[model samples]
Target chain A: MHAIKTLSLSILLGCFSLPALAEDPADADPWEGFNRAVFSFNDTLDRYALKPAAKSYKAITPDIIETGVSNFFGNLSDVGSMLNNVLQLKGGAAGQDFGRIMFNSTVGLGGIIDVATPMGLPEHNEDFGQTLGYWGMETGPYLVLPLLGPSNIRDGLGLIPDSMVDPVAEVDPIRTRNQLYGLRIIDTRAGLLAAEELLTGDRYTAMRDAYLQRREFLVNDGKVASFDQDQF
Target chain B: MKKSIIALAVAGALTAPMVAQADATLYGSLRIKAQKLEGTSHDNLNVTDNSSRIGIKGSSELFNGATAFFQFEQAVSTDTGAWNGGRLGNLGVKGDFGTAIFGRIWTPYYSFTGAPTDILDNATSASSTYVINAHRASDVIAYVSPDMGGLTLAAAVLPTDKGAADDETLDIKHVAANYAMGGFTAGVSYLGFPAADVDVMSAALSYTAGDFYVATRYENRDAGVNGPTEEDAYEVAGSYTMGNTTLLANFINDDDNVDDVISVEVQQKLGKQARAFAAIIDSNVADGGDGFEVGYRVDF
Candidate 1:
């Protein structure tokens, strides 16, 4: 029954991703399942906590690590190209340009900064699970993968190729590895970082739900799913 | 050639029924952490490391040998309780002859030493310590060579899209070769960045045993086209895996001449997805005793 529930959810989520299913996205945006619950919690935090605290703390507030992390991923544009080979995506025309730019910026500069596009190569979007989907693998079940957050069986397995090509994960020194991950959470818990003191609601539930919905939006390329439509 | 490439992608897409493979699986890890380190050199004092995020990558094949691939990853942090990370978002694409992408991409000159650290694994003083990070360059593009045996070459170019005569005119390029047979693996890479025209060569060798993989590497560099010359670099590391448990340990040396460094790190993976890590780092030079760091991390 649990597996059935997960599968049902996966199908519901999966169906909404098709370019065809988005015809009536107004009623399906921010689909329910795990995402709906997360949206609700994030809304609650914004209403009762984060918004109120922002006015006062904004002045002295430190920025979140997400910026760094996003930069980290943004910096290594070639990772997508490597994965594209394994997944077989539609990027040949641009892959060379993209790969050239990423390789030049990252490795050439000791990864201190990206020198990819400013040079010449164009950017490309690619990954494994998408390759699997393009290859015919079923999405399996919609699962909130414990701490790693949102995922379906298909994407879960997709990690294999991503990890395989990830230059950071491939780095050896504990220093470089740790440094890459060094600023991971401070920014993640930005709202919670300072406001851990002002909570009137269940923080865990609030965080967990918010996390799940965020993943859903991310995984679906910002497209709104069916169940998410009912929410305001 | 491009036609055949698209044909292949389209063929791959055709094999997979649209309904069964509709939405690509979305996966990524969000790491929320804090790190403080004391170091010499550079103006930033008692710098606080900021590294955290959540990203998504997916792809679908077209009937003409083309595959639709993309990724959306942003800094996931608590600023205003919304998706906020100065790094912005990124996307990618790949097919036939090569691949292409957009969004923030890594600069090549900086990517040479992809992994040359000891015990720092993002927990200690070493997390944000590298000298090459320039944040994410926008409107970026890149490419790679199809593997011929263990040899695959790649390169990237960055144009100062800002439309300025004196805008950033730096060019970075790199090529890497890797080989794997049974449990033994080895790799060598080269980098040439002309903005500073620093030519560098990095090599790595390793082997795996019963959940444990050990590696050693060395880097020889000519610091810049005309800047002060720096030191050589070297390191050794090992990762042990048993079931869901993997342990990592390493010792590293970055003899940058100006401010040399020696460090160590030990980390235990609770599972493939999460790890608890710790490290100690120190840098000594003409100035004086430099720095140190210690911490733990959990990724989701």
Candidate 2:
């Protein structure tokens, strides 16, 4: 568990700091103000909110995994695409579907292909944090979310990339790169399987805050000081 | 009159061999475009893309870790409730062995070699080419193998659903292949029509050599109506991302023996859900050339 947290932290830091390795602080990113404001708003969420909500994420890890697998299989429409190009495999009775099944077995399930999984194959693990960091974004303010948890501007930007890699995100890289595509559906589902129980408060507010703070942490890589929600 | 519907029902029958589980899902893309037309002043370009569709897909866990599944797809036009043709239907089953789709779906033929959307503001009407036209033919089935060390194989057959015809009898058949790994990807496909016997072959290659994405496609169809009748299309497109804006540019060439055409497009996005796009196309046929056209599209 400690290793997981540490690794997550390292990845968060690496993704946000890449592009600005040498740039001067003077350059404003145009949307920096909106970024700052949203960043501040999200951070407040943690102080007045999320740490308690995280208990739910912690409890439902298994369900998150399940839905994650489903999502992975749902997107791999092109698994059999390549072979059809070289051979004129007609569509009817001679239907070809193994490409899809195998993809679902591996990528969808988070690389636990059972058979395919043994080949040292691993899941194409993508999350909101890694997404923002990959895009050369910077982790801005340190914020304690209302119902979510710690976050910042960099994390907010990270949401775009995270959603980009999200199994549900319509765009891809995450779409095609999912190795154990099918398993991811299950893994993500399994991860959140328990959340269904604790979802009482303003479930909407809780979810909104949790999602925002998570995105914030992903972008900032947990680098800055916590935001004071009282200011907002 | 209702051959298309019969063909559609027959497709559902094909997948019956495999037992369906609760996993089966229905999904598809729906697009409605309004544009301006060229030569024939039809006023606005009330165009519906062959791209619009809906499908049901799902899988069941079989014994010994194997899984069985199937998918059925249909062309759904917002402009018109009726299907475009046989090219729109597809159904098939998949197991640990591989995936097979029958009825009417993307032929491995069109999967790799279909024409680009850039040729026309809309495929149903303004299409400068018919190489990937799925509406003209029907009753096709295809199969794809499981991934082999990241490589997979696929093929399809477009059977002649009709008994026989007097003047025009459409009998279509085809095959195709694709390989993608890392940043470099390449694909090729071919389609054959037995009656008029028009054969269309298409190939696409896209490589993400870094931050920029470069893609190109070349397709040609022998219309057969006229000796050496040509229905060809080509596209050269590339995109680059800077901050929130992803800039895209594309150039296309469409030739159908009847009309020789060229088009260009540029697009930008504000974020994930919104975009601004503009394109211009010029067609020069065997007869006279229809100057130029400018167009745009947005997604909700």
TM-score between candidate 1 and the true structure: 0.42
Error of 1 at B251 (Å): 2.6
> What's the CA RMSD for each of the models?
24.3, 20.3
Best-matching candidate per TM-score: 2
Worst 10 residues of 2 chain B by lDDT: B116-125
How displaced is residue B30 in candidate 1, in Å? 3.6
Model 1 DockQ class: incorrect
lDDT of 1 by residue, A12-32 (tens): 344233333334433433333
lDDT tens digits by residue: candidate 2, B169-238:
4355566777778986677776666666567777877778665787777777675632355766676766
- Taking the tens digit of each residue's C-alpha lDDT, what string does model 1 give over B93-199? 56666566565665332333344332245432332224333224555565655555655455555553223244345554555566666776666766556555466
Off by over 4 Å in 1: A1-232, B1-28, B32-50, B77-90, B96-98, B106-113, B116-120, B123-129, B134-139, B160-170, B195-197, B225-227, B243-245, B257-264, B282-300
lDDT tens readout by residue for model 2, A132-204: 4546555554333332323445554444443333333353667554544333333333334344344445433
The C-alpha TM-scores of every prediction are 0.42, 0.43
